[model samples]
Target: MATNQDKNHPQLKFETKNNTVNKLITVAYFITIKYNPDHFLTMFKKLYNKDQLYLIYIDHTCSIEVKNMIQTYIVHLSNVYILDSFYLQTDSHNKYKIQLNAMQYLLNVSAKWDYYINLTDDHYPLKSQYRICEYLSNNKEHNYFIYYDKSRYDLDTYNSNKYNYSGLIALKEATFSESRIIPYMSNTWLILTRDSCAFLSYSKQVDHYIELYSKSLLPSNSFFATILLNSDYKRIIINHDQRILFSKSEPIELILKKIKSNNHFFIRKMNLTSNSIIDKCIEDNYQLPLMDKKENKNELGLNNNQQN
Candidate 1:
């Protein structure tokens, strides 16, 4: 159902201070959703751009009606795709595998993007797409993820399971290996460069660690950081994911205050109602004046307000 117009949509570009023109950094985003189809669609609409790519994985356990609804709604979007291959269980290791599979699928779909971002249904962007692209364009070489050395935590009795593997043993089995890759834990969210994405998607060492971590508890927390930290990509890694974690029970007004005070690009655990409010807040704070808007319109030859 994709149209020629969708395929030929104008790419986003910005001019540098030295008067050179450069393409705005394009992002490939993969989102995993399990429930609340309507909420997911709303988030998708807010984040969608024809110039970028989106791959959605709906948990197979989700109802058929919910899955069909999401599919039918995004059917015409050329840049949006749904992963329909296999069921993803709630197991921790399965989540790690799903991320790896999604990254590989994205590499097969397009190699033009500059970055890869993974999100869940509860996440929402705090900054506009233009702002995100602009920031990334400025900092293209760095990868963003928050990581901690495994030695920092006392894993003695943590999330123990019937496998009877001691926490230390599980950590070793999950991350450490004969290659001497030091184990690290990280938040699941990440912002990785295209090269890092390719490395994680196709590298042999990454595959080895994937197999090594197959049975480890909460491998998703360690797999990516471990791989990147032990590789040459470690030099470009930035320890911040640029996301604000918010509790659903928190007041929206306080959340708005925190958002205005901080420079995070996204927030998580937001419901639809709170998301709408935050969206308005971003618009008000970042809205350009009429003269600037006119100049941008002339330069880009497209309405900045247009959404997919």
Candidate 2:
């Protein structure tokens, strides 16, 4: 009973055998209105491993048939959970709340994980689960995020002509705030530490701040970054999310070049209609050595720790 996907990509059947790393990572995947369910399923199948947990959230606008299809695809996987449908508006103005809700849910359900990563359904892994786990394990305490500093750029760059505030004002407001806490620009996807998630989930100040900005535009983009950068976790922020590459569809050659040069672990907005892109990515990534052993030892300062 092998399906077209199963027959075409036999390696997916051996995800566990291929992923020998032991570190645990949790993922929260948010789906937009336009994603292909089949592509999303393929992405999950490729990244699946016993050491990780995957939470999927579908936009409320999607039809019940779509949800049922997603449910059927992932129902058999013990590690994958489908969240209740929520109004995940694609409008830039209304996106913050949905992202926050997904984050809040992940934090509540899987607080024990070492690291948690957020991704959109359009994203696909550039590296295998073992490689991603190895990278995170080597930098156990560091959080990966991309943020812009106000010193180099003006605060007004992220704001509107009508209003300007010092911090997140509301989820849909047109103004931008220069947070003394930590002024950062907008990039939603990030990887954070478990403790950071706990702080965001439980901190009274964070709760109050979020309440104030509940109506603010893109609050999720800045709220967590502001909290982490303004707090004790500030120094540990890595300022880079290695899992994603932002370029739109370029030839595979250029993408490969970027991967080697930048150490990217994933890329987004790939063509869902074709498997050639993912096939090439997997072939190239699998041939590359897992994170450099010596660098892991020197960077993490472990005594000959072995990854199976």
Measured with C-alpha atoms, the lDDT of residue 79 in candidate 2 is 58
Predictions in order: lDDT: 0.68, 0.58
When summed lDDT is taken over every stretch of 10 residues in candidate 1, the lowest stretch is 292-301
What is the lDDT for 217 in model 1?
64
Model 1, span 57-176: residue lDDT tens: 988888889877876667666777777648668457687778778888888888788889998887777656766777778776777888777766765312334466453355654345
lDDT at 74 for candidate 1?
A: 70
In lDDT terms, how accurate is model 2?
0.58
Candidate topping TM-score: 1
- What would the per-residue lDDT of candidate 2 be over residues 69-102, giving only the tens digit for each residue? 7766655556566666555564555455555565
Residue 261 alpha-carbon offset, candidate 2, angstroms = 3.7
Cα error, candidate 2, residue 11 (Å): 16
Off by over 4 Å in 1: 1-22, 156-170, 173-179, 248-254, 274-280, 286-308
